[model samples]
Target: MTTPQWAWAFEAADGTPVEGTVSPVFTNRFDAEQWLGQGWREMAETGIASAVLLAEGKVAAPAVRLSSDV
Candidate 1:
C-alpha cells in the first residue's frame, strides 16, 4: 500500500490559496498538526486566514481560522 501524504492547506480570508505560501508536507498527521500548533501564529501574521489539514490532497479536517479578524 502507498503511504498517506499529509500536508497543510493555507488560505486567505476570501478562501483562495495564499500567494507565496508553501504547504509543508509531513509523513503523518501528528507531526503536521504539531508543526501547525507551533507556527500558526506566524502564518496568521503572514496573511494566512485559515488552514486545513490535507491527506492525500483531500481535506482531513475542517478549516481552522488563524486570524481572529477573519
Candidate 2:
C-alpha cells in the first residue's frame, strides 16, 4: 500500500490560502490531520485565519475557520 502524503493549506481572513508553497510534507495523513486539529488555534493566533487538510496534493476536507463557533 502507498502511504498518503498530507499537507496544510493556510488561509487568510477572507478564507483564501496565501499564495505560496505548501507546508512541510507529512508522511502520515493521520498525524498530519491530528496536528492540524491541535495546532489550528495557535496558527490562528499567529494570523492564520483558517486551514484545510490536503490529501495527496488536493483538498481533502472543508476549510476550518479559526473560531470554534464556526
Candidate 3:
C-alpha cells in the first residue's frame, strides 16, 4: 500500500482553523499538491489563508500562503 499524507487548512486573515479542513489521505505528494492547487482559491475565498502539508503526520514544510501577491 502507498504511504499516507495530509494537509491542514487555516484562515489567512487570523490563522483560525476551519472545520473539516483536513484533506482525505493522499497516496503521494504530487496528488496532494495538485489538489491544493485546484482548491486553494476556493478555500481562500471562504477564509482559508494557507495550507500546511504533512507527511506521515508531521509537517512536510512551511505552510503555503494563498495570497494575490504570490
TM-score of each: 0.92, 0.73, 0.75
Total backbone collisions for each predicted model: 0, 0, 1
lDDT by residue (1-70, candidate 3, tens digit) is 7657565545455666667666767888888889888888788787777788888888897889886542
Off by over 4 Å in 1: none
lDDT of 2: 0.77
Per-candidate Cα lDDT values, in order, are: 0.92, 0.77, 0.74
For residue 49, model 3's alpha carbon misses the true position, in angstroms, by: 0.2
lDDT (10s digit) by residue, model 2, range 9-63: 8888876666763567798877887888887777867677777888898998888
Instruction: Say what the RMSD of model 1 is.
Output: 0.9
Q: Highest TM-score among the candidates is held by which one?
A: 1
In model 2, the number of clashes is 0
lDDT of 1 by residue, 21-46 (tens): 88888989999999999999999998
Give candidate 1's TM-score.
0.92
After superposing candidate 2 on the true structure, give the runs of residues whose Cα lies further than 4 Å from its correct spot.
19-22, 68-70
Model 3 alpha-carbon drift over 4 Å, by segment: 9-11, 68-70
Q: Report the error of model 1 at residue 15, Å.
A: 1.2
